[model samples]
Target chain A: MVSKLKTSLAALGLSTALATSMVSGAFAAAHETPLTGDLVIFSDMSNPAPRAVMEGMVARFKEMNPDLNIELTIIDREAYKTQIRNFLTANSPDVANWYAGNRMAPYVDAGLFEDISDVWEGDMSENLASTKGALTIDGKQYGVPYTYYQWGVYYRKDIYDQYGLSEPEDWETLKSNCQTLLDNGVKCFTIGTKFLWTAAGWFDYLNMRTNGFDYHMKLTAGEIPWTDEGVKKTFANWRELIDMGAYIDNHTAYSWQEALPFMLNGEAAAYLMGNFAVAPMREGGLTDDQLDYYQFPTITPDTPKGEDAPTDTFHIPSSAKNKENAKAFLKFVTSAENQTLINAGDALGQLPVNAQSSVDDDKFLKEGFDVLSNKAPGGIAQFFDRDAPAEMAKVAMEGFQEFMVRPDNIDRILDRLENARERIYK
Target chain B: MTQATLPDTHADRGKRSFWRRNQIAISPWLFLAPGVIFFLIYVIFPVFQSFQISTLRWDGLGDPEYIGLENYRELWDDPAFYVSLKNNVLWLLLYLLAIPAGLFIALFLNQTVTGIRLYKSLFFFPFVISQVVVGLVFTWFYDPTFGLLNVMLGWFGLGPINVLGDPTYVTYGIIAAGLWPQTAYCMILYLTGLNGVNPEQIEAGRLDNARGWRMLWHIIIPQLKPATFIAFVVTIIGALRSFDLISVMTNGGPFGESRVLSFYMFEVALSEYGFRMGYGAAIAVVLFLIMLIFIAYFLWSMYRETRGR
Candidate 1:
């Protein structure tokens, strides 16, 4: 028995010595490199291409740091929206995929997300200067943006060529273009409001163009009432489009994807959509030369031009266990080289957020980059949903959709939205 | 003295042996304890917890604040709430049509033909699939551009109707989709009930010159009371709980025109609107009360039937 105890004690001592050496080895490696721990990421990139891109990124990340471990749990988009709130508080992952702007406010306000300002101290701060404002809340940065895309009019260049029409520069030209398109037996615009947010794109552009960016911001922040005259003016402009039969008939029955055929078949002259719609349009047999990108026609000539640019961002959770590794991952992922790698991938059609990052020499990207990078009077507004609080955004979108369906009920819809705004802001 | 002592000892023995003699009765309760505990935890306890949650103001993430009856008061003023309530009434009224429709289908298919079994299985196919899938299939069928319904209507020069988009017709469209599966479920129940019908009574009614409607009313219908009772109960519950179809097809859209209580509760609690858990709980409590009234009546009727038997 004594001999057995001595043998066990020796074994224990040897194991402890080995463990100590391993710990020292890891610490030495950590000093040399910032990546040496397990990182868990919860992503909502459920689409096939985005999922593939994410998987590829993870593989490349693994190659960069052989010792670092990554656990990516990609969830469906709709499910992720609800599940994030639960997981962030109860079982937070080291990193999470989210949107920028007001969409990130609730989580940031609740302290569920970590402030990664130190990550933004050097190269990142310079590389991603344009996106810095979006991730900042209360003068503290909470996330890092990777990519964003511009929303604008994707018109049939061939149709415009056939009619000898130049891209509209202002509201009068836009109305005349619609008349020309209508006279030529083609719809002026095609949209699918079945998902509701598509209507918000129209509302965003109209409101920003008419009232400028400050008023749009104030309106979405619930500082301004929905019944405000500026809001009324925006609707009146939208009503002009409806009056001129700008959109396709029965648009509410189709999703944005389902509405693509109208533009592809030349039944509709243009689609006001994001850059992501370009690939689909090409796939549907519209050649690159046949389609051209243009900003939404100027509604009010002197109103500073505000464009919708929805940004996708990454953040570290406050309850993250491998925070150091997460920071390392964020830095690695948001690097100019890595951002270029993601931009080049087929999963995303959006431009890299890092100003220094290179993108594929694609035509639409060049046009979007030019338009978005230009000094517009009003600057950029994230899409309506991202700009406004989630509750207000939902009600606003519904109201917008209802207005599209029946423009006469604008008063009732605005009244309802005002009630919701008061209640939600209260 | 011995006799008196014996009588007292016998009484003491009787008292001690009572539980021992009733072990069979006690064992059943012991067996039921686990199920009862689970039911209380999962079903009964949550009902009361939701009621308590309704009196508070919570976002499901932050600390809950007590604001008694405010949520209910908000519900009173909410136009969306009224829309949901009105739609629910429409659903209840229209959803009942499935019962008679199911009986009609069951009676038509109640035959011993060579492929009748196959036919019955095919008829039951919709109920077997998930309602989510049914909603999708119906949504595609109602699509304005390429839907089969539109294509067919095109032939008649009648419609390219936006069935799921227009507020006036959206609820009816959803109800029609719901009825597809619900009718199939009811048909199966009636089919089983029909198999247990008394042949002797049927023959007696036939001999007395009763046939068709008369025969079915006096003989078959009376005997199908249990099946009808179960069908009504399930259909009512199903109508009240019609969330999946509405969620999949409309998501209470085209201006929240087709809102139902179950869908509204989910929208309020979960969705991108952020979690107004207390408000959602209040909506849930109202739905629960509505369901409770029907359930109470069902239980009372069931008790009466058993007591009379």
Candidate 2:
């Protein structure tokens, strides 16, 4: 009788376990089975708007195609360059962000990036044309540029008002403003070169305003010498500003984000940075009416002007598990409506690549559009460190810092940069 | 009588041969498999690949051009190479100070008292946190304007000295940060050793009027030799492999002033600054060789001690 009871208890336990497993399976089936394959996208932008827009698109894509899944990883900008290279070797992301210039050359050569020339020819010609060959290397398009922002001097209008100064249009006027601010016990400029990339903005703006677009391309492509006289003159101009006590101390110890307090407290008069500084300005309690943008002051009268507007681009990796799904998502991302949603968001202060799209009516963006549309003749992207190899850039920025602290060492600085260029390029 | 003798001899021979065959088959494998597999996977295979690649000029991607010895030749002229080597030596020399300082602390806290156990644990706390956190803490502490050290100096009307910004003091500042956790680690090792030291010996020394420095040098230190040796070995390796502190604090900066060999190797191979993988491997090989010299000395000492035992 005891053995029969034990047998019945065992049967009951087995049935209960079977029922639980079956129930879980039924529930899983009932849940919307989105895409089942894998897609990985790597990006450097960590702001909420871009993430929201991209996540929404991923969900939509997953719902439309129930055999695919997507994972998006955001790397901090400083570490992305090194970390991305490591990722490419073993398990490359299906799609990833890469720079558009000679920076992509190394990866493209290694077959790390997929050759999407066919994608451009068939589906993305408009996207290709709008980016102006920025994502093309060796007559082949490897990536699609999704966002870009103009770089320039962002200044406090209240300080300009207190000093009876208007936004300077040329080098002479800019120098005069700096002197005036110095005389009035206000720091003329604020910069944080702690990570060293922020210094590139100033250099790019100065170079673009001095040399034309062709020279900028030549510099980026490693065709021009680092010790060129035009470059030297830019350094000399920067030195003059530094000598006049134009910049804040301990700049080396602070990131650009950390310098917000200086501007919020009215300790520093201006910041030379990308349009993305608008978010920080708002975060620091500065209303749009308080902050304003001006073209970086002209350095040469006849120089071809260029906008130092850095851009972000997406590339399909060669190692993607599901290339078709990734390409489909890429198509979805570049669709006109999606581009509009992305541009209207807070993550990127980018104007729409699609000319016909309606941008969100923000005053700051309207002002940005006005500046971009009416930009100086022969406007091109800024070409300081981005134009140079990363190795040369590291040495060159350090040289800039040294020159800032000790203006007399300009000759040594130029020589060292030239030496670095030679060593790095070879 | 001859048949009986032959059968006995054959039985004895068969038994002896069976045992011998089994021993031969098993003993060789038992000695070889663990060490050979481990060496192949962890050390030998990787070293061979690194050596093969050091002859090829590859940017870590694409087809590598077999340019033999070119990377090593380039290393001869690389100034940053020398700077990193010098910084590494400095790291080693200064890092050794943690050993004696740790021993000093262990002696001080060896006495029994209320809350003494908590005191020992509190002293060991820095070692528990990661090197990355320690680097950040020190970076903030060495900030010229806002750092604790500078603020204290300002109270005395002395310094707003740029500890990290100036290339001169940058490496020293990083070394000071590294020492914080490293000293804590050594202190714990010594504390454990002190707890196990013969109390009867201490009492006997006290009877002989041997106390303080004389007692420590002649009696205590000799007894703690194994702990001292282990402490020295770990500190040496930690100092030589000092990468995280440099990376987190300065990124080998103020114009690459604080770069040790390991960070320099990484920057050369994979950083945005460059991707000379061959050159980086060459640097690694050089570092490995330097480390091997010390490792050989350690092994030889261990061998002699064991053999004597």
Best by TM-score: 1
TM-score of chain A of 2: 0.85
After superposition, candidate 2 runs with Cα above 4 Å error: A1-47, A60-94, A121-130, A318-328, A382-385, A406-409, B1-32, B199-209
By summed lDDT, the worst window of 10 consecutive residues in model 1 chain A runs over A21-30
Candidate 1 lDDT, A110-206, residue by residue in tens: 8899999988886667778887988999888999887888899999999999998889998889989899999999999999988889999999999
What is the TM-score of each predicted model, taking all chains together?
A: 0.92, 0.87
Distance from true location, Cα of A398 in model 2, Å: 3.5
* Candidate 2 lDDT, B1-309, residue by residue in tens: 465456664575555555453765888888999999999999988887888888888777777789898888877776678889899899989999999999999989989999998999999999999999999999899877578989999889986877877778889999999999999989989999998899899899999999889999988999999899999999999999899998888877766778988998898887887787888888888788888888998999899989999
User: What RMSD value applies to candidate 1?
Assistant: 9.1
| DockQ of all predictions against the true structure, Cα-based | 0.63, 0.35
Per residue, candidate 1 scores C-alpha lDDT tens digits across B14-105 of: 55465655766998998999999999999999999999999998877767899999999999998889999999999999999989999989
Clashing pairs in 2: A35-A68, A36-A67, A36-A68, A306-A380, A308-A382
